[model samples]
Target chain A: DVKVTQSSRYLVKRTGEKVFLECVQDMDHENMFWYRQDPGLGLRLIYFSYDVKMKEKGDIPEGYSVSREKKERFSLILESASTNQTSMYLCASSSPSEAFFGQGTRLTVV
Target chain B: DQQVKQNSPSLSVQEGRISILNCDYTNSMFDYFLWYKKYPAEGPTFLISISSIKDKNEDGRFTVFLNKSAKHLSLHIVPSQPGDSAVYFCAASDIVSGNQFYFGTGTSLTVIP
Candidate 1:
């Protein structure tokens, strides 16, 4: 089984604060994704990386950036946290077929 | 524009009854479709999937039917259980497009015992 682990289960940050959410996958999958899920908004992609140094912007990448310095780790960075950014963050790793997800991190920005 | 759409925000079904969740997509280029189930505080898990080449796929009590002509798909759960109550999200991917997925909002289903 594949394991995707997030750094935090819950977090609270003040407005304008910078936040980092880390995700690591034990499996050596080539693809990793970052998504934010909101009520009635479902899962919106933030960023995705196909290789250690290759990154692609998803539909909703505003106020966010990503790093994939290594094959097993992907990080989401919020330059300036805002209330609108408060939502559930999910990380997933996959090959060409199915993807496995992390437990998720609930971020609250006041 | 939202390529994938799940119009029903919620659905209710009695125990042992059938639960049907619908999803529609506007993009004809989508070649692969997937359904995910999500519980509170948990990330969405893969439920089932169907490729454009097939119209239906069944696993136990869960069945997924796809209509390529209509650009729609539906998930049917038989003998619905309380454990089945959760949010179901529909997603589509264009295999030619690096398998990039476009997800619908989601539909929350509640099973009443």
Candidate 2:
């Protein structure tokens, strides 16, 4: 089955620490996205990569960055973890039809 | 501002009843719209999608209706079961604009048995 796998299901980090969330897709989709889901804000896109090494800022990319070094993997990086950055982060890869998501990584920055 | 909006935060329905989740978007350039179902602690999964060319699309128990003129879309679940209870999200994207997909706030649906 086609799959998008997230490296960690849950994480807790100290404030000011650099954090990394890894995602990999076996479907070879060209489009990969990173989003954080908050209560009332829903899923706000942080960053996305359309091709290897090509990234674009999304609606809420201020506190996050992404790396797409290889075709099957996309990584979300938090330069410095903060309490406000604690949220459910989701990774997705898409083709022309639809997007497939990873199980998600719930990160807690304290 | 949120380009896509799901006004309802939550909805409850009895078993074997119809459940309707609504979404509206401000972008007219969006040519593809989709619905996703998410359970607690899980990533949202693709449910159904409707292209701008078609007004409606059905897949078994789920159907998505799109009205381009109004920039509105709705998902209908007939005879919703308890297993159907989950958070639903609506998303829209215009391939011409880019590969980015805009999502709504989401509606949490509960189907009581």
Candidate 3:
């Protein structure tokens, strides 16, 4: 079994605050993804990394950035948190055929 | 435009019965389809998958059927259990982008015991 771990399960921050979400996978997969899930809208990709120190913007990448300094760790940074950014964040990793996901982090901005 | 769509937002079924969830895709280039199951506050988990070369694939109680002509797919869970109640998402991808995928909004399934 593969384990993808997120730094926080739940978080609350005030507007204009900077937030960082961390994800680590034990399986050493080549691809990593960050997504924000909203009701009725589904999971929208925010960022994805194919290798260490390489990142690509997904469909909804505004106000967000990512860092991947090592093979097992990927991080998502919210430069300035806002109410609209409050949603469930998910982390996923994949090789070529299958993808695995972390438990997820629920973020709230007020 | 939503390329992949799961029209039904929710479905309910009785235990020991079969639950069918449908998904449709408008892109003809999609060569691989996958199903993911998500629980509350958790990331989606891979459930089953089907490649374009095959029309049907089965694993345990979950089976996925793909129709290339219609660009449609369905997941059938036979003898559904209460534990199977969750949000199911349909995803599609092509080989051009190294398996980059597009996901549907998802359908919520509830199994009553």
Candidate 4:
């Protein structure tokens, strides 16, 4: 089965700490995205990479960054974790037809 | 501003009845619309999709209707089962922007048995 794997299902971090959430896809899809989901806000895109070494900012790119060194792996980085940044982070890879999502990582910044 | 909106935050329907969820988008450029079903603690799963050229698309128990003129869309579930209870999200893709999708806030649907 095709898979999009997120490194952690849950995480707890201290404020101001730099955090990394890694994602890997086995489908070799060129388009990959990172989104943060919250109550009453839905899934807001943080960033998306259409190809290796290429990235674009989404609707909400403030306070977050992304890296796509290889086609299969896309990493979302929280430069400095804050209490408000606590949300469910999701990774997705897409083909022309549809996008497949990971299990998601819930991050709590204390 | 939220480009896509799900006005109703929650909806409940009796078992074996039809459940309807609505969505509206502010952008007229969105050409492709999709519905996703999400269970708690899990990612949303793709449900049904409709292109701008088509007004309605059906897949088994689910049907999605798009009204291009009004910039609105609706998903109908026939005989909604308890298992159908979950958060439903409506997403839109602008073909001009390489099919990147924008999602609505989502509506929580409950099907009572």
Candidate 5:
């Protein structure tokens, strides 16, 4: 079975605190993506990595960054948590046909 | 600007009835399209996909229809069950543009039992 695991199911952080959301996929897929889902905005891509040690910004990458040091692991970083950053974060690994997603992480910033 | 868009924010359908979700894209470079179903607090799951080369693809009760000339696509769910209630997102990708998937705003679907 294809599996993508996210580190946290829910998290709460204070403003100015740094946050890290980790994801790992057993499929060893070449592409990994981090996205945040908002109520009306849908799923907007934050960052994506096509290969290890490589990262590309998505539509909304203002307050976030990503790292992919290893092939199976991709990490999303919140430089400093802010109230506007509170949302559900999703991670996905994609092959040529489809992308398998992790459960998701709901982050609340206060 | 949103390259892909789901104009409908919500749709309520009775059980055993057909549910249709629509999506439109502005970019002509997009050659591949996909539909994903998402539940509350869960990540979206792949439902179906269609390529530009093909106009339609079916899997079980889900069928995706693509109209290249209109830059539109729709997903049809036959005999939708209550379990089918969720948000549906349409995504598009341009193979030439790093194959990064672009998603629409999403349509919330509710199948009443």
Candidate 6:
């Protein structure tokens, strides 16, 4: 079975602080993605990396960035945390056919 | 514009009954469709999928049906169990672009014992 592990299950940050969410996959998939899920909005892509050091902005890229220094790890960075940024963040790795997702990190900004 | 849509926000079913979750997409370019199940505090897990070439795909108790003309798909869970309770999301992608999927808002399924 494929395993995608996330660094944190839950996090709380103050306004104007920076936040990092990490994800790692054991499957060595070539594509990694970051998404934020909100009620009635579904999962919106924030960023995605097709290869190491290669990143592309998804539909909702504002206020968020991503890093893929290695094939197994992908990280999402928030430049300045705000209350609007609070949501469940998910990481996914995929090949040609299927995608495996991490458990997700619930971030709350106060 | 929202490419994928799940009109129903929630559905309730009794155990041993059938549960149907529907999804519609506006983009005709999408050739691959998938269904995912997510629980609170957890990421969405891949459940089943169907390609545009095929009309139906079945796995165990879960089956996905696609209607290319209407750009719609539905997932049916037979003999629904309590464990099937979760938010179900429908996603679509064009495999030529390396499978970047667009998802629906999701439908919360509740199974009553």
Which candidate should be chosen as best, given DockQ against the real structure? Answer: 6
Off by over 4 Å in 1: none
**Residue range B1-113, candidate 6, lDDT tens digits:** 78999999999999999999999999998999999999999999999999899999999999999999998999999999999999999988888875477889999999999
Task: Report, for candidate 5, the interface RMSD.
Answer: 1.4
- Count residue pairs with overlapping backbones in model 2: 0
What overall lDDT goes with each candidate model?
Answer: 0.93, 0.94, 0.93, 0.92, 0.95, 0.93
> What DockQ number belongs to candidate 2?
0.76
lDDT of 4 by residue, B6-113 (tens): 999899999999999999999888898889998888888899999899999999999999999999999999989999999999988776667467889999999999
- For every model in order, the TM-score on chain A comes to 0.98, 0.98, 0.98, 0.99, 0.98, 0.98
- Residue by residue across B43-108, what tens digits does model 1's lDDT show? 889999999999999999999999999999999999899999999998888776664677899999
Tens digit of per-residue lDDT, candidate 4, span A71-93: 99999999999999999999999
| Tens-digit lDDT string for candidate 2 (B19-42) | 999999998899999999999899
Off by more than 4 A, model 3: none
Candidate 3, DockQ to 2 decimals? Answer: 0.65
* Residue pair clashes in candidate 5: none
Tens-place lDDT per residue, model 3, A2-109, is 899999999999999999999999998878999999988888999999989999999899999999999999999999999999999999888666778899999999
Off by over 4 Å in 2: none
> In terms of DockQ, which candidate is stronger, 1 or 6?
6
Instruction: Return the top candidate by TM-score.
Output: 2
Residue by residue across A6-109, what tens digits does model 1's lDDT show? Answer: 99999999999999999999999888999999987888999999999889999999999999999999999999999999999999987665778899999999
Q: After superposition, how far is residue A5 of candidate 5 from its true place, in Å?
A: 0.7
Each prediction's DockQ against the real complex: 0.72, 0.76, 0.65, 0.66, 0.69, 0.76
Compose the digit string of candidate 5's lDDT tens values, residues A1-110.
Answer: 99999999999999999999999999979999999999989999999999999998899999998999999999999999999999999999988667889999999999
Native contacts retained by candidate 4: 0.58
How would you class the docking of model 1?
Answer: medium
Kindly list the per-residue Cα lDDT of model 3 for residues B1-113, writing each as its tens digit: 78899999999999999999999999998988899999998889999999999999999999999999999999999989999999999998885576467889999999999
Clashing pairs in 4: none
